[model samples]
Target: MPTVNDVEWDLVGISEIRWMLGGLSRQRTNVIANTKGFPDPIAELEMGKVWLRRDVEAWIRDNRPELLENKKGPTPE
Candidate 1:
């Protein structure tokens, strides 16, 4: 299996996605997840849903670029 750093490892679960989005509330996360063009999950595991970081990043960039401006983290290259 590939390591996180080896691969883009953009695939992430709901909680991780929430954290990436600055720790959004569960309700808000649900709302955002259901929004159109929010990117379909790569897999639906028992733990929760997963999404491609690239897809989510694209959505955020196209819909809410402002969020990126305030974010503080090592953004994917």
Candidate 2:
């Protein structure tokens, strides 16, 4: 069995999630993040909340499959 140390967690923050969801506005991202079906954040720190990348991706897969197409990089700031 794999130990916790053996696992690699790909964590993400609000900005990263904003990028994942096709560069939604910060307000929109906050709305989506707080939606009932959205995954609960894995941790919260001084910088902000952080989530598991896979969880966010899974939510996208189920809720916003269209965004995945042509998903290459984050939108410019």
Candidate 3:
């Protein structure tokens, strides 16, 4: 939850995204990932893709505002 010296940003993969969206299933996460204009992942590793937490959260705020209503602050742990 710490962004050291503003260089180490938080990242979120499918698991974190799912957890953020209330335990969404993998398929659901895929659907969201495939959505047009969904933020492009900052990195794609062997496990899957990873997105900057801020990018993902902003996308959610703009595209799915409801998701952010109950969430705590800009980033949720």
TM-score of each: 0.73, 0.80, 0.76
Judged by whole-model lDDT over C-alpha atoms, candidate 3 comes out at 0.82
Best by lDDT: 2
lDDT of 3 at 28: 99
Per-residue error (Å), model 3, residue 58 = 0.0
Per residue, candidate 3 scores C-alpha lDDT tens digits across 1-77 of: 33556655688999899877778898999899879999898779999998888888888878878777767557645
> Could you arrange the candidates by TM-score from highest to lowest?
2, 3, 1
Worst 10 residues of 2 by lDDT: 1-10
1-77, model 1: which lDDT tens digit per residue?
Answer: 44566657568777877876778987788788988878887678888888778878888888877788887566789
lDDT of each: 0.79, 0.87, 0.82
lDDT of 3 at 6: 62
* Residue 10, model 3, lDDT: 85
Predicted candidate 2 versus true structure: per-residue lDDT over 1-77, tens digit per residue:
33569656798998999999888898899999999999998778999998888889999999998898667567779
Tell me which of candidates 2 and 3 scores higher on lDDT.
2
Candidate RMSDs in order: 6.6, 5.7, 6.8
Clashes of each: 0, 0, 0
